[model samples]
Target chain A: MTIDKKLNGTSLVIALEGRLDTMTSPQLEEELKTSLEGITDLTFDFEKLEYISSAGLRVLLYAQKVMNKQGSMKVIHASEPVLDVFDVTGFVDILTIE
Target chain B: MMTLTVKAHISNLSMVQDALGEWLDSIGCPMKTSLQLQMAVEELFVNVASYAYGEEEGDLTLSYEYEEELSLVRITFRDQGMPFNPAECLEQEEESTRLHVEDRGVGGLGILMVYKTADQVHYSYRDGWNILILEKKL
Candidate 1:
């Protein structure tokens, strides 16, 4: 999946427009690494995202951990399949979604 | 009607992944399936890269067999690392009762994704090695 970043004050909005899985998780990680310092709020947009693998969840967890220290993270527009992934992993409770 | 195989050191992940991605493209896998495969490939291979060698370099072999008529691609990740199958981990409670974020971790999400994403995942620890096979139906 392609990850694009936008910084709005304390919140960091990462819009993912592809698939998140094993191999690509590192790419997302790299993207976050360059941008994650001192950020309080995080937003993830799964608008064009099609799928997420366990590897992807691991990456999300890392991001959540980072945000937890400073702020909160929100995930928006999770598709049914992707939502199923969150449900299976039980990450729904940890994240904010609408 | 095609077969591709490559065995490389764990550090060359991108080169190998790009090759596999190219092969998948040639096989005409749908975009969504392609992304899932890519994620699986990265996760499985990275696990081997980090945990398998441990201050030593080990070999990783990847093979793709295409069944054009069936629209299926079977990717096998073979490694000489410690025998570990992320799929065998127990499922966490649907409602977890933990107070700390530390409880959140070392959880079974990675392996769960493997089982959830792949159509079939076969794991066998034989011949002194670990073999994880991932299948995606296009």
Candidate 2:
């Protein structure tokens, strides 16, 4: 997946494209790990993301846990497939999505 | 109905998903059903690829079938690497939900999605093959 990062004040926006699965989740994890410093609001733009698998969800879960300690996180513009995955896994209850 | 055998590796995930996705699409599977199937397929296949062989490579056979009478789609995954039952793991994950979010690890969520999304799930070991059968209503 292609991850585009944009920093604005204390909010950070990361836009993702392509598929997020086992092969690509580590990339996102590293990206979030290094970029989350001093940020209080994290937003994920999934408008271009094709789909997400459980591995991808795992990364998000970890990111959420990390963000929980420092700030807040939200996912926006998720594709239908991604949203369905979130729904099936009950991530809708755990993660803030728009 | 179709059966496909591929190397049990993470890199082959999209290839399997694409093949199954096309077939499901051709059969006019609903978007919701197809998405759920895709999720379960990835989780189960990834599990096999990651843990079944224990640092060795193996082959996994996936058989896809649709029962018109029941309007159900079934996918059976078979591998000879190890006799692992995902249903048992799912049971453990169900009970682990009591743990706090901070204490929760991300490992078992995949199998949990398999159990949540698949309408019927069965695990069996026969002929040295670990077979997992997952079905969803169309």
Candidate 3:
């Protein structure tokens, strides 16, 4: 998966492309670990993302937790399949989606 | 029925997905169903790779059969690793899903998803092989 980070002041928008599964979630996890130090707002742009498994959801949950204390995080432009995963996992209630 | 055997390693996830995706596409499986199947397969495969062998390398065999008449697909994962039944963890995971995000733990979510999305999930230990079968109606 390709993770593109755009930092405008304190807001960080990370766009993802391709599958986010067990093999790829760690990459995003590591990226967030290093990039989320001072960010006040975070956005996950899933416009180009193709798929997401539980591993991806885990990372999202982790990010949400981190941002909960620091700022706010939301997911935007998620595809139907990706949305379905969030819905099935009940993450729709926990994470902000747009 | 088609089968593909590969090492139970995290790096082989794409290889497994590609082969299965190609077969699903050739069979005209709907995009939504294909994605769900792929997710379930990843969850199960990763489970085996992470926990089944316990630091030892092993092989995971993925066998799938499509029933054109009923529009059903049955996929099986067989591994010669430790005996673990994914289905047994469903109850606990289900409870965790209902908890608040702060209280929820990350473990077992994958297996919980496989159980929720797949039409049927069956597990068996036969002749020292851990066999898991997932059936989905396309």
Q: How well is candidate 3 docked (DockQ)?
A: 0.76
Query: Per-model TM-score of chain A alone?
Result: 0.94, 0.96, 0.98
The candidate with the higher TM-score, 1 or 3, is: 3
lDDT of 1 by residue, B52-75 (tens): 767776677787888777777888
Highest TM-score scorer: 3
Alpha-carbon shift of residue B50 in model 3 (angstroms): 1.1
Models 1 onward score TM values of 0.72, 0.90, 0.96
Candidate 3 pairs with clashing backbones? none
DockQ of each: 0.36, 0.54, 0.76
Give lDDT tens digits, candidate 3, residues A1-98. 89999999999999999999888999999999999999999999999999999999989999999999999999999999999888878898999999
Model 3, residue A56: distance off in Å is 0.8
Off by over 4 Å in 1: A1-12, A16-41, A46-56, A65-71, A77-87, B1-10, B90-102, B106-108
What does the lDDT come to for candidate 3? Answer: 0.92
What is the lDDT, from 0 to 100, of the residue B98 in candidate 2?
54
Q: Model 1, range A1-98, lDDT digits (tens) per residue? A: 78888898767889998667555778998888888888888899898888777667768888888888878888998887788777756677766777
How many pairs of residues collide in model 3?
0
Please give me the total number of clashing residue pairs in predicted model 2: 0
lDDT of 2 by residue, B10-101 (tens): 89988999999998998889977887788789989999999999999999999999998999899999999988988778767765555566
> Second chain of candidate 3: TM-score?
0.97
Off by over 4 Å in 3: none
